[model samples]
Target: IGSRFSADTFRIRDFFAMNRVNFTWIDIESDPQVDELLKQLQISEGDTPVVAFGNEWIRRNPTNRELAERLGILSTLKEEVYDLAIVGAGPAGLAAAVYGASEGLSTVVLDRKAPGGQAGTSSNIENYPGFPMGLSGRELAGRMTLQAQKFGAQLSTPREVVKLEFENGYPVLYLDHDKCVSAKCLLIATGASYRRLNAEGREQFEGVGVYYDATPIEAELCGGSLVVVVGGANSAGQATVFLAEHARKVLLLLRGDDWGKDMSRYLSRRIEQTKNIELLTNTEITRMTGNGHLETIEIRNNRTGETRMVETRAVFTFIGAVPHTEWLPEGIETDEKGFIKTGSTVMNSPLWTAQRRPHFLETSRSGVFAAGDVRAGSMKRVASAVGEGAMAVAFVHEYLKEM
Candidate 1:
C-alpha cells in the first residue's frame, strides 16, 4: 500500500507538497490499478514511489531537483570547467552563483538535497527584506533559485561533495558516486541542519507523525487534531501560527519559562495573540509512542519534577541547528563548534602561511571562502546569507587576480 518508512519517499513528497506541485498519489495496496501498473513497469515489491513519465517509469524515489532533471525541466551538468563552484544551494551559494554568472563567470552550484537549505523549509518568513507582506520559505527560495538560474548559473541538486583536494591553485571538489568538479575558486556555504529531539521512539515515528517543519502537508493531514511543537525560536513560533489554522489546538512546549528569550519580538507577540496556540513553558518531550504513526507523547516539567502524557499524532521540533562542516578536511580552519573561520581570523592560525593577508570571508585555505550559517559569527538570517554569498564572489575575483 502506502509506506512512510523510506526517507527518499518522504523527501520527494515533501518537495512536491511544499511547492504545491499537483500530482496524483496512488496507494498500491488501496488502488486496483497498482498491480497492473507495477507489472507493466516490471517493478519489484521493494521499489516504491515509482514515478511514471511518458512511456517509462523511474522505479525509485528522487529529490525535487533530481525529479526535475528526469523530466527534462533541469539540464544536466554537461560542462567540466567553471570559473567558480559553489557547494551549496542555500541563499548564500545561490547568491554567489547569480552574481558570478551575471558577471560572465561560468558558475556551477551543487547541493546534496534541494535549494533553499534550512530557511527554505519554513512555512512563513516575515523578517527577510523587500517582502512587505511576508512570504513562505518555499516561495522565497524558489524565486531566488529562479533568479540565479535566469542569470545563467547552472545548479545540480542532490549532489553531495565528498571531499576537497587541491591541485596547483584549483580547488577540486569530489562528489559522491565518484564524480568530481574543479574550479579556480571555491566557496563553502553548506549551511546547518535542525537538531532532532533525543526522546525515545523518535526514529520509529519520524515521518509518520513527527516532523521538523510545519509545511502545508502536515497542516492538511493534522486538521482537527491536536499537535505539539517544541522549541521557542522564531521557526518554532512560525510553525505554531501556521498549525493553529488547521489543528484543533497547538501545544507550544518550551524548555524555559520565557519564550521571548530565544525568539523574535514580532513572533513572540503573534504567538501570544493566537488564541488556539497554548504555551507550555518549562516542559520537554521525554518519550513518544504510537502503533505505526505517533499517537501520544510523554513530557516532563523541567522546573518541577512532574511528568505527564499528551495525546497527539504530530510533533514538530525546531530546536538548535548544527553546521554541516564535517566533510571538510583538517587543513581548513574551523571554530570549536565546527563553523568555518575566515579573513583576519584565519591569519592568526598556523595554517595560514600566504604572503598576502586573507580577504574578508576568505578561509584559512587561500582562494577558499565560507558564508551563510556555515561561517563562524554569522547572522542566522536569509538576507544576511544572501549578502555573504554575493560578497564571496567579489573575493573570488580578487583571489583570481593574484593567481
Candidate 2:
C-alpha cells in the first residue's frame, strides 16, 4: 500500500504494469483499512509502498530490481558461453530470441528493466499488421515473451549491461552486479528512451504528476482531473485520445504547425473527433507549478508570444526518443544521433576489422549486430523492428558459419 502522492509507489506501479505483473494497489491515503492493516503488521505509514507476498512476507518500499529478483524474473546465468546474446528485450530483441532459439541457437535475452522497451508502454497499437481492431502493448509483449520462452529462449530481466569487453575475440558483457556473460554472437537491440520534458519543475513532478506513457494505471489517476499532453507524434496523439476517456479535459500542446503531419491519420482523426481534447498548436509548456503534486502549468503560443495558465494535475509527454547507446563499446560505430551504425555504414567505418565486408545489420565489430530503433536508418515501426530482428538472426547464422 502507498499514498497517492508517493513517487516510490508510482514507480513500483509503473514497473509492475510494464512488466505485466498482476497485483492489486491499495491507496493508503484513501483506503480506510490500511491503518488497521499497518497496525497488525506493526509497520508505520512512512514505510508504505510495501510489497506484500500474500500473507507470507512484505518488503517496505522495495526497489524494482529487488522485486524482480523476488518474482524470479531475474535469473542467474548457468551457461559459460551463449551462442547468441541479445542485449535488449524489445520487439527486435524478442523477435531474435524467438528465431534464434527455435533454430537451435542457445540464445539469452537480457534487459535492464522489463521487456518491451518504449513500445511496450504504448496503450494501444492499431496500425500494426494483424489484430485489425488493435492490441495493448502489454499484450503484445506478453505473447512474444511466451513464444520466446516456449522456444527455449532464456530471458533475464532487471539485468543491466554496464560495460562491454572483448575477451578471446568474443563479446563479454559486464552486468550491473559485477556478473559477466560472454557470447559467440551479440545482437544490440537496446532501443531508445523517451526524451524528458524540458518544462520547469518537470523533474520534480515526474512520478508525482508527470508521466511518459498513457497506460491504464496512469489513466486511472486522471479520473475527472484536467490533464495535459505534449507532443505532435503518433504517441502523443494516442495519449491524448486515451486520457480523454478518464480525464475531465485534455490540453494537447504541440510545437509543430500541423499535428497531422507527424501523427498517424487515424489517430489525428480520433483526436479531432474527441470532444474533450483541445489541440494547441505551436505551443509549449513554459513552467509547471505545484506544492506536492502538479497543480498548474504555464503554456505559451510560439507564434503569438502569449502565455496562459492551465489547471492540471497530470501531464504526459511523448516528444521524441534517443537511442540507448551510452553503455555500448567503442568498436560499434554510431550515427550522429547515437543510433548504431550497421550494414554498409560499418564497412566504411575505420573500426571494421574483418577483410570481408560486414553483413547487413552487422556492426563494425564482426559478429555483433544491431536492429530495431537502436539501429541507424531503422524504420522505427513495430513490424519493421520484428522483421529486422528475425533478419538479424539469419546474419547470426552466417556469422556462426565463419566461426
Candidate 3:
C-alpha cells in the first residue's frame, strides 16, 4: 500500500530526485485503496503526502535527513532548546534573533513555512534604510538571516508551533508531532497571511499561476506573460511596477475608484507613467478559468455591470492580510479584525496586566506578549517591525526581572 501526496510533496520529491537520493516514488493518487489507508493513519482532509517506513507512519513533507536524525538513522540529534525562542521569521522576528543572539542570549528562530514572511514575497523594498540602491525583499531577508546565523542564532525553517504553553513562568513551544522545547522568553512574531480570492478554480491554479507574493522567482515565470495584480495598496503598486519589467503587460485591479492614499506619491506617479501597466479602478476578479494552470481571468467592473476577460499567465493578489493567530487560544484580547491589542489602559479594566494598568504588548494572559503586524497599532513597515521586535525584547527583559 502506498500513500497520498500533495503538491508540496511533489516539489520536495523533485528536489530530492535532483540530489539523487535513493527512494521509491509512488503516486497514491492513482491507487484505489489509498483513501482507506489514509483514514487508518488518521490523516485529515487537504492534500498531504504520507510516507511509511516499515510500520512507522510519516505524514507530509519530511526530509530524509531529518528522518535519519530523528530515528538515530544519523550520527546525532541536533539540540533544540534556546534562551529565547522567536516565532515568525519576518522583519521583526529576524531583527530580534539577530539582536538577541548577538547580545549572548541563546536565540532560536522558527517559522511555519519558509523564512521571509509577507516581506519575503515582496518584489522590491525601496523604503528600508541603508540600501540607497533599493533591495529585493528576498535579498533583504536573506541578508538578515545570514547576519543572525553568523552571530550564532539558530534558525529552523518550515517548522510550525503546534502548541505554546507557559510552564513554571517559562514559555514552552511544542513543534509538529509533540516535539517540545522550553525558552526563557518567547516572542510571538508569526506575522500575517494574505487574504485569498473566494472564487472558483482559485485553489487549482495556486502555484501554476495564482501567487500571493510577487517575488523575483515568481516573476521570472511570467516572462512575456500578461500578469494581473490585485489590490489598491502599496504592495499591489509595487508588484505591478515590478512585474511590468518581466511581464509582457500588467493589469492593476482596484475595487475602489482610486488607489490607496497610503501609497507613496512617487510610486503612484511611476504607475501613471508606466505604459505597460493598465490601471483598472472599481473592478474585481469575478472568476478564473483554466485546465490546470491559469489561462484567462474574468473581471467585473463594480460600478458598471460590464464584464471583461483577460488572457493572463499569472495573477498576484495583495488584497489584504490577516493575522496568523488561529493557533492562539482565546482571551488574547484582539481587536474586531483579530489584531492583538497592546498598551496600558484604565485601572480595573478587564484586560490582564502583569504589573501595570494597560499592558504594553502583553496579551490578555499575563507574561505573553505580541508584537509587529500581529499587534494592534503596528506601523506595518519593515523598519517599524524591526524596531518593535527589539522593543519587545526590552519588555521581555523587564517582564522577566519582575518575575
Candidate 4:
C-alpha cells in the first residue's frame, strides 16, 4: 500500500511490471480498509508502500535490489569465464542468449534493469511476425527470457556494466558494487533510452507528474483525469491509444504537423478515430506548473503564435531515443550520434586490429559484436533486432574457431 502521489510507489510498480512480477497495488488514501489492515499489521502510514509476500513477510519501501532478491530473479555469475557475455536483456540480447545457449556455448545475459529494455514498456506491438492479435511488450519479453533460460542461458538482472577492459585480448566487464566478469566473446546489445522531455520543471516533476512509459500503474493514476502524450513516433502513438482507454481525455502534442510521418498507419488511424484523443499539431509545451506534483502546462502553437493552458496530472514522453553507449569503451567506434559502428564501418576504423575483416555484426575490436538499435545503420525494429542477434551468434562461432 502506498500514497497516490508517491514517486517511490511509481518506481516500485514500474520495476515490478517490467520484471513481470504479479502483484496488486492498494492506495492507502483511497482504500477504505487500508487503515485497518495497516493497524493490524503494525505498519504506520509513514512507513507505507509495504510489500507483503503471502501474509507472512513484508518489507516497507524496499529498494529495487532488495525486491529483486526477494523475487529470486537476480542472478550471479556462475562460471569463471563465460564463453559468451551478452549485455542488455532486450530483444537482441535475449535472442542471442537463446541461440548461444542452445548451441552449447556458456552464455550469460546481463541487464541493469529488467529483461525488456525500452521495448518492454510498449503497450501493444502489431507489426511483429506471428501473433495476429498482437501482444504486450512485457509478455513478448517474458516469453523470450523463459526460452533463453530453458536453453541454459544465465540471465542476470539489475546489474550495470560500468566499465570495460581487455585481458589477453578478451573483454573484462566491471559491474556495479565492485563486481567484475570476463568472457571470451562479448555482445554489445545495450539498447537505447527515451530522450527526456525538454519542458520546464520536467526534471522536478519526473516520477511524480512526468513519465516516459504508459504502463498499467500510470493508467490507474490517470483514471478519470486528463493526460498528455508528447511525440510523433510509434512509441508515442502506442501510448496515446493505450492511455485513451483509461484517461478521461488524452492530448497528443506534436511539434510537427505530420504525425503519421514517423508513426505507423494503423496507430495514426486509431488516434484519428478515438474520441478522447485530441491531436494538437505544431504545438510544444513551454512550461509545466504544479504545486508539488503536476497541475497545468503552458503550450504554444509554433505556426499561429497562439498559447493555451492544458490542465493535466501526467505527461508521457516518447520523443526519440539515445543509445546507452556512454559507458562503452574507447575501443568500440561509434557514429556521430554515438551508435556503435559495425561490419564495414568497423573495418575502416583505426581500432580494427584483426587481420581478417570483421563479421557482419562485429565491432572494431575482434571477438566483439553489436546488434539491435545500439548499432549504427541498423533497422530499429523488434524483428530486425532478433534477426541480427541470431546472425551475430553465427559470426561468434567463426570467431571462436580462430581463438
Instruction: Compute the lDDT for candidate 3.
Output: 0.73
Error of 1 at 387 (Å): 1.0
Write candidate 2's Cα lDDT for 1-403 as tens digits: 8877878999999889878889999898788799899888888998888989877869999988999988889987865899999999999999999999999999999999898888888888999899898887778988999999999999999899999899999999999978899999999999998898778988889898888889998998889989999888878887888889999999998887876998889999999999999988899998999998889999999999999999988989888889999998788899889999998987878899898999989998999999999999998888899999999999999999999
Residues 310-385, candidate 3: write the lDDT tens digits: 8986888888779988777664667778887766622344756456654476666665667788887888888899
Q: Any runs in candidate 2 off by more than 4 Å, and if so which?
A: none
TM-score of each: 0.91, 0.98, 0.80, 0.97
What TM-score number comes out for model 4?
0.97
TM-score for candidate 3, please give it: 0.80
Determine which window of 10 residues in candidate 2 has minimal summed lDDT: 71-80
The best candidate in terms of TM-score: 2
> How accurate locally is residue 60 in candidate 3, as Cα lDDT from 0 to 100?
60
Candidate 1: list runs displaced more than 4 Å: 1-8, 17-21, 26-48, 58-69, 73-75
RMSD after CA superposition, every candidate:
2.8, 1.1, 7.4, 1.3
TM-score of 2: 0.98
- Model 2, total clashes: 0
lDDT of 4 by residue, 63-82 (tens): 88889888898886774999
Clashing residue pairs in all predictions, respectively, total 1, 0, 2, 0
